[model samples]
Target chain A: MPGPDLLSSQGLRLDGRRPNELRRIRCKLGVFAQPDGSAYLEQGNTKVLAAVYGPHQASKSKSLQDGVVVNCQYSMATFSTGERKNHPRGDRKSQEMSMHLRQALTAAIKTELYPRSQIDIYVEVLQADGGAYCASVNAATLALIDAGIPLRAYACACSASMAWRNGQPEPLLDVGHVEEAAGGVVLTVASLPSTGSIGLIEMSHRLHMDYFDVVLSRAMQGCKDIEVILDRAVREHLAEGWTKQDVVVI
Target chain B: MFQVRKLANLTLFVTTTPTKRYNKINKSDCFENSILPVHFSVYFIFHRTKDYNSCKNMTRHVKIRLASERVNHSVSSNNELPRFYTPGEVITGMQDFMRGHGTYAEDDSLKASVAGVMQKVNKLICIRPLKSRYVGEIGDVVVGRVLEVQQRRWKVETNSRLDSVLQLSSVNLPGGELRRRSEEDELMMRKHLQEGDLISAEVQSVFSDGSLSLHTRSLKYGKLSQGILIKVFPSLIKRRKNHFHNLPCGISVIIGNNGYIWISPQEKSNLVEGDKDEIANVETQTVSRSERETMGRVKNCIAALVASKMMLDDTSIMFAYEESLKYEEVKDLLDTEAMLDVAFLTQHKINYVDED
Candidate 1:
């Protein structure tokens, strides 16, 4: 359990963010010329670059008859953290992060449209602040959109922490590194806000049953807010990359 | 003349000193005036700092810019912009219209599945993405690299979602056009069109799974040798009746519908019927230095057009090639400002033709 230092006297988190304010997000799509689709996203201090290749023919071992295989790899840079790490990927944490990423991304991609194909998504974390998973999910969604892959809706992920203000439980939106290290219960939710569906929900540490509802709802709200930002970014990219063929048809 | 002298002095300073401190100062100075000449000197400085041993009279300049400094080369037309759509955005009620390519029907509403402008023909509504893998239609021309030589078919990568198939029977053998395929031909598959060889073919049929079957029955479509291939977004390739162009500037170009452009020197002699042995020696002939230079200029011109996301066709490419002659050196056109200038001039010529 964390002390009352989780929230200041004015009901702000340790990073001076209000209970419901998300961190600033800056994103760009199609950053790389080689990949089918690529995106770079920054959420507060966490920067993630995602590249998506294929919907092309899948290998024999991974081919599916009814739908496309979603392959996800999550790797962090050796110097991304406070201390220099030796292994960048293939450890226990990266494998689990890769699985979680596939789950959230697969739920949004329209797999049935591409039969016997595969989409490979590679996410490289340059800087890992708190909510790295959330930023990874958001960046992968943008990459999928850039690839022109069909999607049911935008898959957005956001993290929230439970803080107490004057003996009242307040759910903090968009947890930061300081709040995460302070040992508060963090709830991470990846959801399709437009479809009103939850792709994945993960909770770290323990939270009371009554507090779970508020924390989950706050994370869901943050996803909805992120969907708006992502939608705008996609529009801006479309405007810049559109050619004469797209406009002359109308 | 003044710019030439400035360029000469800059290169002299770079090649003579070749120190880290001088290189650092030279890089910033060249970046400020990033025209054609400065681009060459900057390339020289980069070569000196990285590979001191191999620093000969290298004149090639490769421009590297930060992501924040990237220039948006998209040319916005004066016409009214189309209404764009994003994924999951509702296009219309499903009651009156049928969903097409990039749209999906859900909950009595037609929503777009890709981000782009919407197109409607009668009651069908489709949203086309600005960029995607090539979707082959019947009779579409494509250039593909041979990936695998299967039993009687060769797997081709045509920038499509699935690998295209080129059956052994579809290709016209060097001996004759109407020869039947025998087991000998199956054994000689790798010798004819092995892995990593590029060929121009036409889409014969589309499979139910969306893969394309290509054919190289025509004499014009066959093995491409001694050429430069430039790939751009498939959407930028404007469909035309003739994808092959023998430009007046002594070169031939094959603009594959799959967005692969092959710029090669014009063939001196047309292949006569039943000239089987002559086909073997085509790859061995040496291309002249002048022809190679022209091909390089054409390739750089195509790159410039691709940078601006312009529609690629024979006319636009020829216009760009003509506009690029002012730069003198082929490498000069690689500079961003020079590229933009060529693209702008070509666009102006294209618009002029359209108005006339």
Candidate 2:
């Protein structure tokens, strides 16, 4: 149900971005001193902070014999949205977001390495524009990396929406809040781009079966692009914090 | 073709902000697009204008900036940088190399599972992370706080994956090393080292589950009395033959391999050794004002070195302490500029010693 006005006459989206362009992403790793690993990420106007603790002793009930338990909690600030929200978390939507986060992150972490342990990832959304879930996944990935937890590959998430221009279906990459409210079919994909693996896929509103492939691929491409940016941030963090002792093991 | 265009735009956006208008539009778009309150948009605009004005004022006495404006503290070393690998990056073909820690073998190739520099010893290749929870080794000294007192054992948290175990049989009781642990001793465990009491111990063994078993068998290792415990990254602490140092400046420091540092007065140990029965009495002994000042200075010096992510050892600590003495007051060492100065001076001295 995306309106024709979703794209301008010049072939750019409402936010003056090309249909294939993602939102500007800025990130910093090890933002916190206490947590084992922490990161702050901003994708356009949406801001998220993620902290990873443990791979430590799991409590008696949560411990797994085969691998580590990935516990994730996603909470948005009361002021994250334009409206003043009463509850920060524990809502049904927050619970679902937390579960989706675990599904995406568990695929990236090499859990088998730390059996009988738990890795707790807590994501706090400071601002929510659009694609908050995708930003949470990306921030959590950076936190896990900052914690030095072994991972099979970086897990990146991105959301794409279908727009129409000149009687042709156009897949928009990195949907912002405005585009999301425009009644477009949004496809969110969490993937390990390097490994060509999809951890989780979700769709909101219905799209024609023929255009599904296009939207999905665009989202996957966004994830791949995000993986490259995250990889660069990790390398930059390592360079800054790398001491001589890190290189020459005593 | 779309992928190529996307990549090009991404690189362009990352390198330079030709898309500044897009960024501004994105911000304003959220306000206009959503049914959010008009006041919220006004507030955003007000904050933006205020920030812009602050940037224009050159001689402002008090400067306030957002968290996003915080400076990057990473200092690139002068030496040739080491080759670093990230997760899932293939290190080499797994024809002969044995994958070790932070690495996994998949698809006939050894891939790094963590971001760090690689270490190769013969056929064994391992990647060590820049920082992580302390992975204990046998004979490594550690300072841990008692978390739980369970059946004949005390659960001590040593900043590891699992809470380390300190069994009653492993520790030397108050009477002597040869004294048999009686049923009475089991009941008296809480009287000895209760919850939250700090203790210095050595890693006796490592369990198959990767948890450490610790022992306080030596006279040097036992319950820590009144002292300041400073926790740094375990990676910062260098592995040395001597972790306990009685500094020339009249304070003793126990640099636990787990990165828990105990800074206490020097004379306290001598007092305990002289009258063994009065071990509990030592806690009541008030530290002199001068001794407390020296301990504070030493603590600040260590903080400086840790701030710079320098390798911590007795020599490095002492060099920092000596360099910090020029700054008269101990509290002054806490300043960011002073900390950087002390760290820089200590690094110079350490490099000088290495060259010799």
Candidate 3:
């Protein structure tokens, strides 16, 4: 066991959040003027920007006939982490993140709507605070909404870690960088909360099978909470320019 | 000018809440008044929802809503602003309504697949987003830059989902309209329109893949020269019958439906018939200082209208132009405060004119 400081005697997490609490999520759609759809989402200390382009012609190599080709690229800024990384993308970690991002987003997008088309989603992490993947997924969801792409439901992702409190395994919601570096088992879940379907689940480090269900449910609950925030943001975006076309009632 | 003052009051009523943070007020009626203030919680919600003590700068993208003006000003309008729909929200439980773009039928109910306002045309319902890539329709005017020269076809980027195609057959040859497109014509394609050249064309057809086929068959619809191009959200541009207008202010504006606006000096006295050399030389002719100033003013005025989320038509733009005359300096309109002021005055003028 590490320092055991993840949860204090009062059951407060290291960041002063309650075990069941999540970080503050603030997001805005259509941040960039150039891309078809773009969004910036800040989850506590983690900041991510995502842009969606296309549902247009795909290059011959990447084209798909059965449904729209969903291409995703994940990259982090040079100053995003504490170390000042040498490369932004094409590395081993970013390539894996790119693949994982595509899997989660593809589950939400209605690909059949545009056969033989491709939607390119590019995510750039401006700040890294442990749950960067979760923030990136949330930001990409908002960007897809801004692009007017049809989706089954909002795909939300959240992270949880197993922490001991009062001799019981208490799963903390929205694990931050400090808690992650504390050598605890972190469970990340991306799902369509409305549909109760999991798109992707990733776990780093080992946890007993007896404590798995509680940790999973906590992360799932966090996903449900994130969906609500994203939904309200979308509605607010719609209301802002609801009258783009002057309805001609004949 | 008294009408202009009344117009200003109306706009002030609609848009005075941009700087008002949500923590200051908690009124329900304020939600319906405008869109951006409702976003006050977007910044305030973070502080209110969870208490995390860390220094971070929250940058809010300013959104100004002028749509409320149309709803509040029009008397015959019985429609409340269309109810917003988000992805997976059931549009109707009924199976009778046929789904259109931005929507789909799921589990025996009509559900919205996009985040936007729902538009119903009889039995077919579609969701039109506030902003998206340009969806080209036939007979629509567009300004696009050439992306690639591929054989007889020139791929043009029209701010659409895909690059639109401009075929050799669709354009009028320099010498004559009836001339056949020979091997030589294909070779000279880049000479006529190289990579990065801007042109104004009309949407001739929409392919099955959603790409548009553009044509420059008319003399007025060809290579654009010596003008400033301003791009806004395509939805800001109102679809009008005549997008090309030679404003009384001595500048011409092309309000492309694709959100590309080109402003240039009005063609000097309309070139005489069959003078291809003179028409070509018009590109080389220097634009005078006064004409350049007028174009700059028009460009800024259009930017002001776009920033406010107001419709961009010739009349609205002209009204904005007249309102901007007080600033004297064309570059002053680029400032956020000055842009909002001009947009407010323009809205007031539009609402005033509508009342008459």
Q: Best-fitting candidate, measured by TM-score?
A: 1
Per-residue C-alpha lDDT of model 1 across residues B250-346, encoded as one tens digit per residue: 9999999998889999977676745657766678778899999999999999999999988999899999999999999999998888998899899
Tens-digit lDDT track of model 2 for B222-329: 899988999998999999998999999988999999999999988544555647557666787889999999999999999888888888999999999999999999
DockQ of each: 0.56, 0.40, 0.30
Per-residue CA lDDT of candidate 2, range A146-166, in tens? 998999999999999998888
Every model: Cα RMSD to truth? 6.0, 10.6, 12.3
Ranking by TM-score: 1, 2, 3
Interface quality of candidate 3 as DockQ: 0.30
Off by over 4 Å in 1: A246-250, B1-68, B270-277
Query: How many angstroms is residue A70 displaced in model 1 relative to the true structure, after the best TM-score fit?
Result: 1.0
Q: Which consecutive 10 residues in model 2 chain B have the weakest lDDT in total?
A: B1-10
Off by over 4 Å in 2: A246-250, B1-77, B268-274
TM-score, every prediction: 0.90, 0.88, 0.84
**TM-score on B-chain, cand. 2:** 0.79
- Residue B180 in candidate 3, Cα distance off native in Å: 3.2
Regarding TM-score, does 1 or 2 come out ahead?
1
lDDT of each residue in A1-250, candidate 1, tens digit only: 4755787897777777899999999999998888889999999999999999988988889889999999999999998889897889999999999999999999999899888889999999999999999999999999999988888889999999998888888899999888888888889999999988999999989889988999999999999999999999999998787767834343
- Which residue pairs in candidate 1 have backbone atoms (N, alpha carbon, C) closer than 3 angstroms, thus clashing? none
